[model samples]
Target chain A: MCNHGIHIMEEVKVIEIKKSIFEDNDRDADNLRADLKKRGVYLLNLMSAPGSGKTTTLIHTINRLKDKIRISVMEADIDSDVDAIKIKEATGVESIQLHTGGMCHLDAEMTRQGLDNVSIDNTDLVILENVGNLVCPAEFDTGAVRNAMILSVPEGHDKPLKYPLMFSVCDVVVINKIDVMPYFDFDLDKCKEYIHMRNPKATVIPVCAKTGEGIDQFAEWLLNEVRNWQNK
Target chain B: MHELGIVFYIIRDVKKVAEENALKRVVSVVMDIGEVSTIVPEYLTDCWRWAADKEEILKGCQLEINTIPAVTHCDDCGKEYPTVAHGKICPHCGSTRTWLLHGREVEIREIIVPNN
Candidate 1:
């Protein structure tokens, strides 16, 4: 046999790298959380479906808490500056837009990149308005101290049942558009029950972002959370 | 789609492994994809092909997926059943106190490198 320049390998080496694809992202998220904790900053990841009043709720909450809590916002969308602009214009908060290129979700690394632009030292709370989707956002941790989702009245009470993972991952479930509850078949109690079933420790708050009703409760919850996070 | 994002993660992980082992090229990557993992295997492989070819180390790398069957355990009946057939609710006891035992996994099992 004439041996050419091509060398015949002895054996193929198989490396046993049994690891989850999300492992790296999860570790990054934990590090980010710890860093934020050390800096006394609370990062809140807010997720919802499109047109679920996430922006409106944020504007309302930011307006109420801006005086007390030093707040900043990061809006993550596939491609849009509308949210960032709206949030900045509405609340006059330091807001930045993060385009995920074409990604459906924002991982911990992307969250950290977005946070780099914000003045983390002066900010007590940084709110990440995650891309409006239930499934993908829940799959990736954005290194936030808390996770919240707004379930509007028009979206029905069966959302928790349909998207169990989203419900399970959420620390708080904000039921927005409660003013239209009379017009819709959405049952608030049933919705709370379903949310509790998925996550017993989840705090459910009903709010009308349009009317500014129940915004105080949400604000109070957030203020206490930020205080507790900083203290701990 | 999420498949593209997942492909990027796989490429990053593979490149890191290659760097650690001082390997030049990878031949195949094996993955254990659970049935209820919500990742379509076809889409994943298609995305992997499009992304892997762009990487010098994974130019023609093949992705092999092992589908793990979805299983659910019933707390009430103390029994296990196929999750796809009966979801959330236990079939034997007709109870909603059922949780997934396994089937939501997206793991990279191994990588085969060509011996230099």
Candidate 2:
């Protein structure tokens, strides 16, 4: 029995490898960012919950900026090409859909695959509409030059306090559905304050996607972002 | 679902390590999962069992998780506290100016392989 135990112990070996699971993904993301920078392609990863007016806001922003900049859109979903069709039909820009095969979020590798299908050389900006989730998407960087998120008024001002990680990572936070703020208890000032609490430098843009109100500001921000990216 | 996605990443990493060492079969994978890492241990292991079995090298590989307790540092009071209980706030001083020092890690500590 002692010989048997020794034999079993000898057959098993433990190797020390203290590495973060996200390390590989993070490295891939950095490499992708460098490649995009070399190509002068600004990839914006837009994330938010489902029904947060991401598609509508994209349509409005694309319509405003398409004339000035060569734009493309990549809509990521578990299943469905509806968003891809909508963006193309509404703005007439090159748009494609990426199905995540029931995955919750798009990692850097998946984003790279999606970018392969788009005309990166001809396009100045590629806005990737990430899977509609506030949790998982924030954890995985999609190698975008910048990260943005939408928070509809109905989702409440307390969202920033709840999903702190999501708010913290986003460079810009677009507060949508502000037109209905009068009916709901969503306080605009409080929402901004909460967002600032989580992320001091996060630019908060409030817009009503349904009425196209305050979309010009968002468009202006995107234009400046794209211009700065190209020049940098 | 999120756990399943993480399992795929783990599998990929382990496979690369196995290839580098010329390991034919992985006996077990040890992980360091933080308290606030947002990964449920139960869900992670369940996902691991399902995904690891599909891979030839990782067939029947055991997944062992070490829970790292989350600790937050208070910038105001210069004290430390448990993050899971206080959560972004310093409980001793009631200050909102706090940051997580650790416990957001989803790391692979090591891998157990057969000797020969």
By TM-score, the best candidate is: 2
Q: Which runs of model 1 end up more than 4 angstroms from their true locations? A: A1-11
Model 2 interface CAPRI class: medium
Q: lDDT per residue, candidate 2, A1-232, as tens digits?
A: 4533543566788899999989988999999999999999999999999999999999999999999999999999999899999999999999999999989999999999999999999999999999999999999989999999999999999999889899999999999999998989998899998888788999999999989998999999999999998997
Q: Tell me the lDDT of model 1 at A86.
A: 96
Query: Which stretches of candidate 2 lie above 4 Å from their native place?
Result: A1-10
Tell me candidate 1's fraction of native contacts, as a decimal between 0 and 1. Answer: 0.85
- Report the C-alpha displacement of residue A173, candidate 2, in angstroms: 0.4
Write model 2 residue lDDT over B77-109, tens digit each, in one string: 999999988787788999887888999999999
* Per-residue accuracy of model 1 over B1-116 as CA lDDT, tens digit each: 87898899999999999999998988889999999887899999999989999999898788889999999999998999999898888889998878888998999999988766
lDDT, each prediction: 0.92, 0.93
> What TM-score, to 2 decimals, does candidate 1 have?
0.93
